[model samples]
Target: MKKYVRGLAIVGVLTLAVAACGSKPAENTAGGDANKDFKACMVSDSGGFDDKSFNQTSYEGFQAAVKAKGLTPVKAESKSDNDYPTNMTAMVAAKCNVIVAVGFKLEDATDKAAKANPSIKFAIVDSAPATPIENVKPLSFNTAQASFQAGYLAAGMSKSGKVGTFGGLKIPPVTIFMDGFAEGVRYYNKQKSKNVQVLGWDDAKQAGLFAGGFEDKAKGQNTAQNLITQGADIIFPVAGPSGLGGLQAAKASNGKVNAIWVDTDGCVSAAEYCSVLISSVKKGMDVAVQDAITSVVDNKFDNKQFIGTLENGGTSLAPFHEFDSKVPAELKTELDTIKADLIAGKITLESKAQPKAS
Candidate 1:
């Protein structure tokens, strides 16, 4: 009878252990599960993933999403615009649950891929989805606001009382930054009752703007030099890889000139010219990517546009870095005030499409 009781007790203990194991949460699994195997993929624009600007920012966001959601991620770097469709299609074929296509250059390809793969979720950065497919989400940034702060800084710091702005292309996103920079300078001049002038891309005409046609460092360098010759001591280069030219120009100018970087933190990325970089207009791609991944993991992914603005912490000015000591405390306080006013709608930074110049 004692022996029989011992056998029954051992069976009861084994049954309890099995029941507890079976009741464990899905998230606590040792190797994860089928649902956790969801794959996210990103395809870069012609600039590739290491342009150190928009492309790099978007790629970081995608990576953030992947890591947060415990998702497997695949990346396809396009060498040119022609490769967008092929790369996007390859990701779909690889069973990617979500596809992120970076840049306006990939708009057409993204549209086509999203249409062909109705079941796959799509996120297009820097461009809106044409058809508003059920699974498509468009992400855009209010870069103008951040650029405005940069303009304010440039205007205040300018020894020549003149600032210059340029971009790789005259696209909406690029021009928006230029417009904000110009307007910010104008705003500063109006507020301080100064006469600081801004050149390149007339906010009204949106024309007469210099476009190096993307990624030609030489053209960017030439443009910066011309602006400097015209008495511009501060330059804002919104161009991609081409913006490096402006940095180079600033360096060669013997510390008489300075510049503002775009997208990523130029202080770290452009160490050679860190001394000349007042600050960078940063877009919070990392946070956005992480949020998207979390949404996917929670099965709450939605098809809508995500806007990164100052209010949302999606975009802002990078640290002053080496220039911190040079920036006046009053100027910093004034900048903060301006930022709050802009967010509160007390001050408006115009974002209307600039009229074409005759």
Candidate 2:
């Protein structure tokens, strides 16, 4: 009855019955009889294959595509910023049909390697080059839409009537979640005539809390404790693996706090925190990665940008696992309406981090 957890290097496997739990289908890579020799490869950022966040999610998708299509898989994991270029170059040298570069920091490396090896198709996660690269497909998400829902959920569930959020950095990708989260709290206040306070972010000022980096769990834990002390009963962290600190902080809160997660479904990816997980604002890195690999393998590869929106199933709110019944049915219904409204343009989230349509 516990949540699923995937180990480092090895990928995910579901524990519960998918239908009963109301989770979305895992990324599909099953078709394509052509291009059996097509090789799919990836060059990871320093978090490498075990980040369980951006890097791991993308690799999982690429690996799934390799397995389903019977295509060969190749990978090189970077251990530092300096390793990005070297790892990418190695994949290119290996003649990988599609080379995926994980992380926004890999922009230069992906562009450089893509330009040098023009024949090979490329996919870049969480970034698009400053200049148009006709051979590189950019896979990015409008995570704000989903984070908004998490914010609203936190606001409704908070015993203290306050919630907090912090980021790995103040970058657009991270701040986008904060902006939408603040907006969601504000929206909840407006709708319910509640004065729910959102600590750590001010969307109008475009600034607030940030832990500075993705690797420091101590910073994340400290940030969570500080926010909890401020009467915020819930905290959302966009700090990749560092978000785990929020979990530890919540578990130590003497039943006064809960944590919302980002990137992937933390309920599954970080089962150790499942007892306190409110939910996750997921970016479909796995699907996008698999799509990129399959496109090349299926001989339909294009350099078009793939923007993940809630409507397109690219970004979403994960189910309340341990907290399923704890979340009121009425709040769940409202979230469904908000999702449809956002997709229908009846409700809109404004953030520059939103990936543009092709």
Candidate maximizing lDDT: 2
What's the residue-level lDDT of 225 in candidate 1? 88
Model 2 agreement with the true structure over 1-358: per-residue lDDT tens digits: 1111111121222111112223232322223534455667777665557766777788789778877877656666555566666666656665667878777777777888888888999888777776668888888788889988888899899889989998877777788788888888888888899999999888888878877777778898998888888988899987776777878899887678999888888878888888889899998989998998788877798887788999899999999999999999999999999999889988888765666665
TM for every model, in the order presented, reads: 0.86, 0.88
Error of 1 at 70 (Å): 3.1
lDDT of 2 at 92: 64
The C-alpha stretches of model 1 lying farther than 4 A from their native spots are 1-36, 353-358
Clash list (residue pairs), candidate 1: none
State the local distance difference test value for candidate 2. Answer: 0.76
Give residue 315's lDDT in candidate 2 (0 to 100).
93
Model 1 Cα lDDT, one tens digit per residue, 240-357: 7788898899989999999999888998767788999999999776677656656766778887778788898878989999999999999999899988988998888776632111
Q: After superposition, how far is residue 319 of candidate 2 from its true place, in Å?
A: 0.5
TM-score of predicted model 2?
0.88
